[model samples]
Target: MLENWKDKYIVFFDGECGVCNFWVQWVLERDKNDRFMFASLQSDFGQKFLNERGLESKVFNTLYLWKPGQYYYTKSRAVLQIANVLGGVYRLSAVGKLLPAFLSDQVYDLVSRNRMKLANQKCFLPDLEQKKKFIEV
Candidate 1:
C-alpha cells in the first residue's frame, strides 16, 4: 500500500514526538505542490526503510526525507530539502546550505536531544484531504 508514494518525497518522523508532528503539519500546510508524503518511523514501512539502509530502526530522533530509487537525506539536510521543495517563502531556507554540514548537523542533534521536552504530545487530526498524505498511520 505504501509503495504508491515512491514517486514523491517521503518524510519519516517520530510518531510520538509533538515537535515532529508540528513540523509535519507545517509542511502539510505549505506543500502547495503536493510533492511530499509522510510516515511515522515506528510504522512497518518506515522500519523497512531504516533497516534496509542499515540505520537505527528503533530510534526516531533523526528526520528523514527519501526520494525512492534516488537518495535520502537525514537531519539538517532533510529539513532543508523539505523547505526547498515546498518553495515560495520557504525557498529562503536555501540559505542554510551555505553553512558547513557538520555545523548544521550539530544544531539538528542538539534539537533532537531535547525535542521531547520541547513540546507536549497531542493528537493531531488533519482534515480528510490532509490526512490522505499520510501512510501507514
Candidate 2:
C-alpha cells in the first residue's frame, strides 16, 4: 500500500474532525481515476510528513495534498488541486484559482475552526477496495 501511494495524490486531513472525514469521503466517491490516497493527520506517516516539511504536526486544521516526489499543496491550494485532479465538471474549480490564496485560506480557516460544530461525528465504513486507499489507518 505504501509503495502504491507514491504514484497517487495523498490527502492528509484531520482524522477526528467530522467535516474533514466527510470531505475525504467526498473525494473517495468522486475519484473515478483512483488518483487519491489518504492519511489521517494524527498517523505516524502524517506526523513524519509534517515534521519533514517543518509544519506544525499538532495543528490538524490544515489540509495537505501531496504528490510524493512531485509537489504538495496546502490550504486553499490543496482543495483547488484536488478538484482539478478529480477532473470533469470539477475542472470548473479553476475559477476558484482566481481568488487570492490569502482570501481563500481565510475561508478555509473559518470552516476549519467551526468544523466540529458543522457536523456530528460521522462514521464512514469503507468497503474493502476503499479501505486500501488509506495509509496507516
Candidate 3:
C-alpha cells in the first residue's frame, strides 16, 4: 500500500469541519501539479493509515500528512510541510516550523478546536475537475 503512494502525498482531515474542508479545497486549487490526495479522517482508509502509523486515531482535529513510506506529520508541522511542497508564498509558512513544537501546536489546537464554530456549517464541495484529485474512501 505504501508503494502505491510513492508518487503522491496524502492529506487526512476532518470532513465535517467547514474550515478543514475549505483548506483542502484551497490546497487543491493551488496544487497545480496535483501532488496531493485527500481523505477524511472519518473514512476507513484514514483510520487504517493512522493505525498503521501508530498515531492516535482521534487526532483528526488537525491536519495530517502521509508521505508514503516516510514518517507522518500532524498539526502545524503537517500544514507547514504541505505548504512547503506547494512552493511560492505557501512555502513561506514553513518558516513557522522554527517555533517550539509545543507552542506552535498549542496555537494550532486552539484554532482547530474553534474552527467549526468560526466557519459555521458551510459544506465544502470541490468542482468536477478537482473531485478527481480526492482519494475518497
| Best-fitting candidate, scored by lDDT | 2
lDDT of 2 by residue, 1-137 (tens): 67799999999999888898999999999999999999999999999999998999887989999999978999999999999999999999989999999999999999988999997786877889999999994
lDDT of 1 by residue, 1-137 (tens): 45569789999999899999999998998888889999999998899999999999877899999988989999999999999998888889999999988999999999999998987787788898987888884
Give the per-residue Cα lDDT of candidate 1 at 66. Answer: 94
**All candidates: TM-score:** 0.94, 0.97, 0.90
In the predicted model 1, the residue pairs found to clash are none
How accurate locally, in lDDT, is each candidate? Answer: 0.91, 0.93, 0.83
Off by over 4 Å in 3: 1-5
- List model 3 lDDT by residue over 64-111, tens digit each: 987887888889889889999999888888779899889999999999
Q: In TM-score terms, which candidate is top? A: 2
Clashes of each: 0, 0, 0
Q: Where does the lowest 10-residue lDDT sum fall in candidate 3?
A: 1-10
TM-score, structure 2 vs. true: 0.97
List candidate 2 segments past 4 Å from native. Answer: none
Cα lDDT for residue 24, candidate 2: 94
